[model samples]
Target: MADGSLARMGPEHREEAWQRLGSDTFDLVVIGGGVVGAGTALDAATRGLRVALVEARDLASGTSSRSSKLFHGGLRYLEQLEFSLVREALRERELMLTKIAPHLVKPVSFLYPLTHRFWERPYTAAGLLLYDTMGGARSVPGQKHLTRAGALRMVPALKRDALIGAIRYYDAQADDARHTLTVARTAAHYGAVVRTSTQVVDFLREADRVSGVRVRDVEDGRETEVNAQAVINCTGVWTDELQRLSGSRGRFRVRASKGVHIVVPRDRIVAETGLILRTEKSVLFVIPWRNHWIVGTTDTDWNLDLAHPAATRSDIDYLLEHVNQVLATPLTHDDIEGVYAGLRPLLAGESEETSKLSREHAVARVAPGLVAIAGGKYTTYRVMAADAVDAAAVDLSGRLQPSITDRVPLLGADGYYALVNQTDQLASRYGLHPYRVRHLLDRYGSLVHDVLAMAEGRPELLRPLPAAPDYLRVEVVYAASHEGALHLEDVLTRRTRISIEYPHRGVDCAEAAARLMGEVLGWDDATIAHEVEVYQARVQAERESQDQPDDQAADASRAAAPEARPNVSEPVR
Candidate 1:
């Protein structure tokens, strides 16, 4: 199992990675730790190449983490006649659900509300039938049509006027943050040296070609140069800034689209299935989260603060006003439990509207040794990663192997299905409730045993946190031990949903999370204090910013908080 096992994933073991990164040149050095970067690192490493993945923050701390959390085939893409895109996404979705990450990805059903009695049902069903046929994968049930009474049964919160009928279709869902971490850890498992909180300060050039990156470890003040034969730039929205640092004119501009989502308690709108509604700009989703519903998403262009996109009051109002139209009992500001905003990296075009620009990705050879990839959806990240690596591989003269990631399965995926069947026995063994065991199975799958191992020694790790009762203390501790959770915010916001699940927004539990993380990171009292302060300030800033009127006020309010990109923008010396 030591041939790349979970035991090796603990960041504490590689705490001094910066010291070793400069000691060698890698075959490939990935510039971002989001899904695409992590996937590229894994793909390259698994194909017998030495790789290093660096990120300024924890994995998926951006759009990868703040997604709709659905492995959907973009039902709207059907209407646009992007059948190729839909087919590709559905194939990837099937791979994720069936083979690649059976542990992390599970199917979820959504009710497509049919406003018109006769026309919409048949039309939507025809689209879904095409979707089911396109994938040629049967990991989930096919679409089915239902009458008004059946639709009401699925979504009782919807008003009688909201729909005359509905079509039920399945899409896979995942814990976005956890899945990203799993991808990175899987990359590590394949001999890729992946490190987070390591920012690429500047590019290392050899003659006219960009050779590698000069990176700084954020944990300490040390700097390291990661040399690579070819560098694949998968930095997402920061594509232009990173390429310009190499003094090469970027081929395409990446425009940022700000999408905001709100989380509310499940009781606020009791729905048997997730609801998808047609919006003016884009589609709206009311997803069923753990005891809560994730209602969101306003699509608008954002030009400022790519790191911390704020949810302005107008954005919140737009979402509420749209969603409340269908709800029998409208969800007001008081009903909201949490709010999050993320920027979609869209390819810039003649129009200023971010929603209209292509979600398709672009790859360019900025210099002799660098390939920059930008503007792609999370679901389509694998193809983008494969393409970026393939393009960069052209710079290498050797016979490189073709991409095999389509057949790759992530960690925790090997024995997942069987584990689901034995959930009762596993629960008895762990001394947890049946439902709690099922929850763990859904979250951790076969690796539930790995999670329970900590509790075997401590016994008390089985207990739940005080402020956030949904997660166990072991999960918070394990986040640091396995997942590279550097700060309290990573544990609260990403590792767990406490940041958005609890009404307090992880404020009351910040200190507790800090104390748990301190043990793993060897943090002193001052360090713990600083982590808690930064996390609290972030939550406060997000809340305050969300109350503001427009994007400008929201940006100003969010600026009051600590920045993710601390000091990379200064002219490179």
Candidate 2:
């Protein structure tokens, strides 16, 4: 691995990456830029292998950005008697909290209310006890039993009759998109050629075995061949499609399960800790976001569009109905700030229900030089990546090194705690509030200086955005300049999350953000205006789709919006 390689992913860097992709024959080429894909690239690159990571869209543009944003062992999985999966996930959570990404991953407490008169507390406590001890390393506190009054005191928004008792447990949470992007950047730092808006059109073959891939630049329709010894398919929901494109029969099938989530104002839910409620189908979580509460998620089969999964009116109503059961004041449609839907790539089983499908990942050598991995939780992405690289080792000729990513911290993780201790000094130096400095540190860690450095001469860039005051104007510039944001949606939705956290859903700041991005990307006036119009249309389409009654209608409405990446097309069948 190249020590201290440049991690900047700006436009100039992207051009270099494209040139490298066309000329170099890599040891491994990882497809998909989601968390697992990014993790796979990091794993391969750190092993001193020549690696290249290509994505059709921006990093975490799909399911990775739309997760529940937690790094916990699945409590429900414990009930399902999947102790191994839960234990593995818990170990990964501990790694993320203490070793991997302390800046991005943080401890979050959740209250599980009890409705039954007896047996519920002990039954739940037994599970929590196992959960706390399974990981071997203890970072967060264990579960605490509480009476209904104590629970109500902890969560004043809960109704008096909602729970007889409660059990509060600790878990870790982070911005999934930012975390994924950091993994990709860390891979790039280790000499991995990372490029987005580059789509794989077909598999390149030598004799009967898979050799490499033919990729197209989605922005301009330029095609090139990326030769590699082995290619790993890490596409989550699109796993099956890519496998089919390779002309290889996948050993396992990936089924798409739609999970919908709604974002509401934090004040609407008066809770010190997040809430986890029991639903008829699965568990419901009211997760605590920065200034909002994220409540979701219904597990239903989805066979429609994979790129943009639409959340129908029924899906939103389902979440509101379940969450309102425990809230003192019921939430209505008007209370919602934003809505998003993502598809889970589940390993298909005999059971028809998507919830019943396995959460454990499966890796198989689909072809001589091609490996496919799918059906795993976000917490266990590193493990999945390591396993995938291990499977690809057969295709590689030389003696390969073992995975050392567990010991390797992400790019910004170093000196984060020290930075937190010096927040006041940092705020003073930057001429900003300590709170804003703290926010920047959490998002950028030691690299916060890299972000602040962009405003050396441009002082106005440090100021807060007019429409979304929570995010600074400099963040929009940083997204385009360093975060591999090829389009305006990549900035608003994944890089800054202005698309979901605010009431206007980033519409009010579209023009401002587009112009800021244009300055870095060298967009003309017409290009800036087109970007704003496209982003606004996307927001409007999402709103319209959310109002639709069913998935079919919702998919049609959402698909009507123009794609930001003009040349992106479906995979070749």
Candidate 3:
């Protein structure tokens, strides 16, 4: 089948989905459009089951979009003695790198700095040795020992006295938001009915079993009852709330652990390889992103708002203080381009510390027709999805085939490698610079042609946005027409990542992007102006919230701004 036919997911696709939601009974109805939910939809649909997926907001609007963007086996988990989790995650990482999403997931190298002399090198080396061979990490380079001079040469940003030596190893990374969206689109390609901006208000019960769901359209307030043989809940941080709606005493509890990451320009830190530093509570990562660096993550319990986890001044200071210890030139708040906070749905354990909670996921057959899976990291989303669908299989009629998602390439993965080889030719054909064409290939793969095709009649679309030159004008239009981007925030924040990558946090580009998206989404001047205004308010709120002292103050600061989609209510506590 042609790739374009794989469920357009644009405005028209969303309109058609409303008609189908109540028309037919599905074999499985999956709630949540995060990575695991999208993966579950793909897994069930691939097994020849009639499937449907519903998300309360846009795809990857929650934890899925706000990840650290690593596809690594938890190296820290190895020290925790959770070898099974590490091994499973490593296998999944390899699957994404080599088989599942070669277009999206790519290998990345990290330098583990050593402070002590004799014991540190050998100890870290031994652990890395096990990590390399555990799940066939042959696709990436193995560990290499480096002296202080060598390490400094690799990362000139590090303090000369910070590390006695270092060990460099390899892992993988991807655009988490894009990857999650691709999974949902790929599921649609395989005949699953997927709709976003649709929320499950309550569970449909047959006796004591959950038979389906009563869904409400967050956009127009339209309501529908979707009947299904079984329902799989993949709501990550919202797992407990969803469980309560099912009226089931869930098998496990989900604890919210908030993690915050700060983004700075790549020129701020002179590093060829990413850095992994050991902290008292947990390990910290200085991951390399395109033209920028992502320094992150404080593991603290989050009891406040779940939908918008605000990053406070203390949260930013905690990350800056820990990461600053190793830097030759310390990063100040002025140097930061963006700050984001995300909640990790950790499975509750005996330990009082949220950091000590389990990253391993648990799947349970909560009621007769309900299955809930929660508490896994991003790298193993496919495995978690497979397990969720497998639990739901008991209610399925016939003997279903095992998962074939391992063999099914996402929509753009098929001709990506070949297209990479033909970059110069593609550039020549499209009348774009070679570098620009290469960038499009990495982001869109074979779908780059579809995006560039939108610029054929209107040559102005090929030009870059005045404020955000890294992204072309056509991208904003294509995002609305093809990628299911419903608002200005969707394009700036996720579709192209202009929000986090820019200095003004997308304020300067908001009007231009809104205008571009308006042409495709058929928005009037008033609608475009409102979109631009809302985006500006969001950025202003985030900036003010980041300056606040604690979570409460930050949450209030953030809450002052109106949501782009107005009906997006607070998470049910």
Candidate 4:
């Protein structure tokens, strides 16, 4: 293989991996393809270990893709006295912005509105002072206190009476799905056998020790037994279920907390900086996104569906009501372009409320050769991965290296700043706008050349999708050929985020995107038609589900749609 060349997760890669299944024993096998799991694979592989990561579905198809998209110390957690957690997260955030994945994660400013006239400014300022200084929180601006007039100037969408003052602080934001996918690709680049669309049917056991896994390829129903010395479980919300499959009672239980978010057009909220407001239970965020603003997040216990968390009409109404308390122009359901719900794997505690559960993660040697990790925020995924691999190292034979992932930049991270300086020149070289070239540089960094090279002979690939002008035709093809996008949902939902950004929820561009993906994946006319139909049905189902009044009804409405891959199913406990 080319040294450090791109690990193309195309059709050819999957076939070659399928043929090599169980060919040789691995040092460690990782279960789950979410952020932590992908991070664990990279950590182990970079330490010169033979690693294999198996995901039940596509990478970041779970909670990893559905975060608030911030890499910050939980500001509210300070109120709860989670100082250590906050400090650790801030260090990780600084690492992401400066050293690790600078291309994907960048600084974002948030305005925390103050309601009370007295005692609020100093109290809030002191907390923020600690937040900025703790754990060497560098790479972002320190907290800035703003007057009521200044706050309103920053965000005219906010009502004049909404705040007495405000404090603007910087935190890093990332496309969560893209970051997770890049982590998986980085692991594969380091010689880790990263395979998606594969499910662990059962744990291979020798006496009381866990040996390996019995995995089935979800594409064609073929099964294989892969041998490994150690197995690390990073299956976030599904941690309990997988531990049960291992015939071991988990040391800690993972309770699912459902958080729902709604995407509205950027013009709806006239804000230079994102807004953060206090709620009855937790804080509400109006996060700035490209051409859109993500306002979300209702937290409640989720027991209905882990695979597909549906946002009910009540969830939407709750968000609208809380946000409208401060908005000059209230947002209605009609203004919402997209809605999504994700489950956070919280460690079970004495509190009945999911919000009160601990964000701290725990690692347990669940069995002789199995190590399980669960319950941490998305911002601390690297630390969580290091802990999981550190636990797994006990079962490994050779001299293992400590996690050097803190020093290793992600796939598109290296030389990103240099390329950003040449955005104007790059735009001139390619037949594209300067704005478009800058956008590409931010998303792909140094890898923009590789994506642009695909359009070398075929200039048509450089053009944007007719329905979805924000993304190009080559991006769809690249998602299938380079990013591990095996289905249309993979491309639309996670790879490019067309599903959440588009007003039509990717339905308008479904056929076109499927057609582009089919060209790279070698799909027949029938396969292309089927993919389009499935995506359309999914969009229809999501729309219907969002209209439902409660989670039960919403879950039922959403579950009516069929999965993109027929054989892909959640692992049984």
Q: Best candidate, lDDT-wise? A: 2
Off by over 4 Å in 2: 1-5
Cα lDDT of model 2 by residue, 377-450, tens digit: 99999999999999999999799999999998887898899999999999999899999999998898888888
Global CA lDDT computed for model 4: 0.90
| TM-scores of the candidates in the order shown | 0.96, 0.99, 0.98, 0.98
Q: Which RMSD values do the candidates have, in order?
A: 2.0, 1.4, 1.2, 1.4
Model 1 lowest lDDT segment of ten? 1-10
lDDT values, one for every candidate? 0.83, 0.93, 0.90, 0.90
Instruction: Give the Å error, residue 516, model 2.
Output: 0.7
What stretches of model 1 exceed 4 Å from their correct place?
1-7, 563-573
TM-score of predicted model 2?
0.99
1-573: candidate 1 lDDT, tens digit per residue: 112244345665566566568987788889888898998988887778888899887789888888888888888888878788788888889889888988788888889888876677778778888988997338788887888899998889999988888888889888888888888888888778888888888888889888889998876667878888889888887887787777888889988888889999999998888989998888899988879888878888887888788899989899899999999999999988999988888899897777677777899887899989998788877888888888888777587888898888887777778887888898788888888888877777666777788677787889888788888899888888877787788889998989888879999988988898898888899989988888888989998998999899999999899844354343332
Candidate 4 C-alpha lDDT tens digits along 1-573: 122245788899888777666787998999999999999999999999999999989999999999999998988899999999999999899899998888899889999999887899999998998898895347778999999999999999999999988999988899999999989999998889889999998999999999999999988899999899999999999999899888987899999999999999999999999988889898899999988999988899998878889999999999999999999999998999999999999999999988889999999998889999999999999999999989987899978898899998988888888888888889899889989987776777777887888899999999998788988898888889888899999999999888999888898988888889999999999999999899999999999999999999999999999998778766564
**Candidate 2 CA-lDDT value:** 0.93
- For model 3, residues 421-540, the per-residue Cα lDDT tens digits are 999999888888999987887777788888898899899999998788888999888889888889898899888888888898899989889998998888999999999999999999
Instruction: Please give the range of 10 consecutive residues that has the lowest summed lDDT in model 4.
Output: 1-10
